[model samples]
Target: MKPFDFVQPTTTDAALAALAEHSPNVRILCGGTDYVVELKHGEQSPGVVVDISRLEDLKSIELTDAGLRIGAGVTHTEIMAHPLIAEHAPAMIEAAHTVGAVQTRNLGTLGGNLVTCVPSMDSGPVLLALDAQVTILGPKGSRQMDLSEFFVGVRKTALEPDELLLDVIIPTENLGKPAGFIKFGLRKGQALALVNAASAFRVEDGKFKDVRIALGAVAPVVMRASKAEAVLEGQAVSQDLIDEAAKIAVGEAKPIDDFRASKEYRNSLIEVGTRRTLQAALEAANG
Candidate 1:
């Protein structure tokens, strides 16, 4: 790894000032799951590494009147094990399990994963399905944005060079919203997703309400299959409707041909994925 100056700031104000001082030379260090690998490969040799990993202010998972508040630094392991998450937002736990192995899970932060903005990122689909939001801190103070807007492109985000992500929030209305996430990868463990999908909705009086379906690794970013969701909203709940919704979802994605999987195969996965998650989410709603 290339040598770099390291700074560990304990407060957000200090961190912001340090970032301004270091400017383009500074890079924030969270869980280090991706950044460390980049350093070892000589891909990024930043002049300064600000270890925000030690910022205790960023480590929390709580519930508020607005919804479930997850500190950006919360680890995947924590998300999988937290009682509040398991009971109120279990789809999130399902997504967390599909990330890297135990060692990486213990060290990787949700903020880091979202900030990386990889197309197949496991933490994305479920949140997108739930219409999550994010909080960011900067010299201008703080601002909140939808998770969709926070992601700009592959391995990129809407955060400015001097901004730091603070937390992720699932809106109060969506808490415990029935949702499901699935991924089709080369293997059960340590494999990047070839295609992944999630669906969320409520079953009210045998009809679908607020239906949402999201797909990953098939577009520039994790995106909602709005065309498919539109087909299901207000529709009578049934297996046949789900199947049709799945077909529509496949039409919404633009999967690519890659060594991991063919575009045709990914399209197939998108259909099956959409159908299965919808089924699972409906079951959750019924319970």
Candidate 2:
């Protein structure tokens, strides 16, 4: 790791001031899961490293009038073990389990993962399917946007150099919304997802309602497969309808031929993933 000045700010205002002072030379340190690896690889060497990991206000998981407020500094381990999350949105816990091994999960933050904006991030698909929003803090105060808009591209985000991700919020209406997340990696642990997908919907009068299908790794960003969602919306539940919807999902992703998997293989996985998540979510809703 390159030598750098370190600052541990106790308040958001202090962190903002430090960021403004350092401006482009500052890197906000959250969980150090991705950043530490980057530091060792010489990917970044900021002049000032602002450690926001100690910010108590940013390390929480609770319910608010708005919905579930998951602080940016909350670790994956916390998410996995939170009883409120298990009762209200277990799909999040399911996704968190696929993030990494026990060690990484202990140190990684959900906001940090989303802020990194990697295409294959395990935390994204389920959140996207659930219509999650992200809040960013900077010198100007706070700005909130859809998680999709927050992602710019590979390893890039809409955040400016002086900005910090605050948290991810799943709207109250979506609480207990039947959602499912699926990830296909080379191995069970410490493997990057070849193709990951999530689905959420309601079964109203035995028909699908407000269906959402999100996919990752196969696209530049975690993307909603609207075409597939359209196929299921208002449609009666059936294996045939789900199979058809899954087939449409394959057309929405832009998978590439790489060493991890071929384009054809990814397409097959996308179909299977879409179907399985939808079925799982439907079961959750029924229960």
Models 1 onward score TM values of: 0.98, 0.98
Cα lDDT tens digits for candidate 1, 1-287: 88889999998788888887887888899999998887788755688888898887689999988799999999999999999999889999989999989999999999999999999999999999999999999989999999999989989899988889999999999999999889889999988999888999999989999999999999989999999999999999989999999999988899989887899999999999999999999999999
Q: Taking the tens digit of each residue's C-alpha lDDT, what string does model 2 give over 44-158? A: 5788999998888798898998899899999999999999899788999989999889999999999889988888999999999989999999999999999989988998899
Residue pair clashes in candidate 2:
none
Ten-residue segment with the worst summed lDDT in candidate 1? 36-45
List candidate 2 segments past 4 Å from native: none
Regions more than 4 Å wrong, model 1? none
Backbone clash count, each prediction separately: 0, 0
Task: Give lDDT for model 2.
Answer: 0.92
Residue 118, candidate 2: how far off, in angstroms?
Answer: 1.0
lDDT of 2 at 177: 96
Residue 187 CA error for candidate 2 (Å)? 0.9
